[model samples]
Target: MSDLFSAAADELAAASAPLADRLRPRSLDEVVGQEHLLGPGRPMRVLVESDKLSSVVLWGPPGTGKTTLARLIAGASSAHLEARSAVTSTVKDVREVLAGAQARLGERGRRTILFLDEVHRFNKAQQDALLPAVETGLVILIGATTENPGFSVNSALLSRSVLFRLEPLSDEALVALARRGLVAEGLFSGGDGTTEEGPDAAAKAEFEEALEVLAVAATGDGRHLLTTLEVAISLARSRHGTGVSGEQIVLGIPDVEGAMGAKAVRYGVD
Candidate 1:
């Protein structure tokens, strides 16, 4: 049946997606880092929850949840979200989004939130194209960049938007994120009825050590942490066999080191 084929396709796509993309926070509460901005009564949280968010620039290091926050803002708002990457988008893309925003507002009175990822990559002209719509309130622009917005963003656009700076995640935050990734990958029990009984105390300890190494090597980048975790999981599974058994796939320090290459040493000599 068509429905069965569609379901199969969806499963395949989900399986092929990166662990970071798959584990991305679906709601503001699920987001791991950026506490300063998402904390209670914070300006960003207040604006997002109240749905009164104006044009804003999220400046941060990679993996600090810029895109995640933007997505959450869009999710919290009644606006339709349109996401584009500056690396692949051009002035024409900006115009198209603006045009669509105009039509959506005119026809249904719905606001549009335009999320531009890696916005620093947008040249002057491309960035300029978004100004009219953003200034007129036709589109709520959420520009995310790993670069300093002050130096990269145009003055006009920067002046019109509130700038929220995101800091690198702390080690504790990165560890928590690693735990979440482990649960999402089914390597750790989720306390659900479907939990698999596996791994004795020794294996669990080894896994914990590996996780700590990964968290340290991640260097405050959540995406890098998850990616390394995924690679470590895969490497461990490959060496341990993929059969569903009572024993969990315990990853050792070597496995974590193998996943991260040179950066793994930052965790300290084994």
Candidate 2:
């Protein structure tokens, strides 16, 4: 009975989570895009694999995998991972994390990796509070920001960390990501819910066109792509009529446009 209830709770939590969060890559192999930083012998991969990472800043537009990379770094290393958003955290919070890191290092010799999301939001004083621990190697700081760190971050703190820039994903990458999301969410047709085989050839063609429309509408952000897909699927499901079955609610271009409140535009040169 307890096991059944636990499983039910887990299912409920997963259903409530955002599709983007649910689909976040679990390992470097599963991660799409950012090939330059994650490819063979890349500096980021080397740092994570060797667990010799130093303080670093990841600068990128929203949904470009800054937080994902930071989490990957912590998972690859033996360090205890701590996460905080600079938008909500204060100087006191920084001091607390540093104190905890100091204690862990002194007592258990365990390193702590601090993943500070939106680090550019931190004011100069709050950032200053983190300098001592970062400098002394008590904590490995992985700061992520959509803003330009060089302009938003304190020069002193910026100087202490290596910076990596992440670019917007390409259109092909966005299409692949949307397709993966469709399969993961079990919205795809066919018996297995993974294959694209639909009830008819027309449905399959519509599904493919819908995926393309979503890929273009996403505008290079993986999170946006997945979110749009999720909403489009839900909208399609809600409008199911007598002929429409659960498995027959495959998305179409109209559904994609309706969910996004705009038509898909051409992405690349003809």
Candidate 3:
């Protein structure tokens, strides 16, 4: 990792852990959800690979990995990423991020990606603040919202950006993702731990049951799903007075509570 990214990751690890962070996709290939938009030979892949993508609006319900996708793009494009929250950011804040974009463009001839989370929360005035900058190509806007953009965004702003709808992850996808996360953390038996160098059938079955319950509760939201998995991992490590069983694993109180209290928003990209 670059020095700046390493520092940022360290800070996040030290600070309050957000659901997005817990569930954050390690890479594009590992992304748990949004296959419709990001699967092989998809339009989004074409646009992103072309490196000339226009501003886009990611419309979806909560937990669909909107923030994760934005982060992935920012990392891949080498763009100066500026994130703003429609819930808390004023027009002035938007302007400041826009200014950063302008400066980065001038200095590096690189594109700037402004990821707006909960974009539906922005009223007319706030969205208006983005007009001039967007019109002039100072930044590429990536807006995410749980609500419908037509109801939240101004027509002009909506018109300027391409809209990409992200679907909730399927149950199979969520199950696959949980196993992958466990593998990534070396919780599975494929490396150094108690078992052989691969996930055993029993472990796989345990994860399958746990993931099914999580997926159903998460309601297709990859963020919530992953956060639950993270909580389970910590619980397993701590040996917190209880053991995981098929019944206890699924709908575990700890995982459910952790997912609920987690910082649902990280940088307004979700």
Model 2 has an lDDT value of 0.84
Model 2 over residues 15-128: C-alpha lDDT tens digits?
Answer: 899989998888887888988888999888888888899999999998888988898888989999999999999888888898898899999999999999999999989988
- After superposition, candidate 1 runs with Cα above 4 Å error: 1-4, 189-205, 242-247, 262-270
Better of 1 and 3 by lDDT: 1
lDDT, model 2, position 162 = 91
TM-scores for candidates 1 onward, in order: 0.88, 0.88, 0.75
RMSD of each: 2.8, 3.1, 7.8
Q: lDDT by residue for model 3 over 176-261, one digit each (tens)?
A: 66665665455652223325343356654544455566666677877666777777766655543356332222223344335456
Q: Can you write out model 1's per-residue Cα lDDT over 25-117, one digit (the tens) per residue?
A: 998889887888888998898998898989999998989999888988998899999999999998888898889999999999999999999
Mind sharing the TM-score for model 1?
Answer: 0.88
lDDT at position 61, candidate 2: 94
What's the residue-level lDDT of 11 in candidate 3?
A: 88
Q: After superposition, how far is residue 101 of candidate 1 from its true place, in Å?
A: 1.3
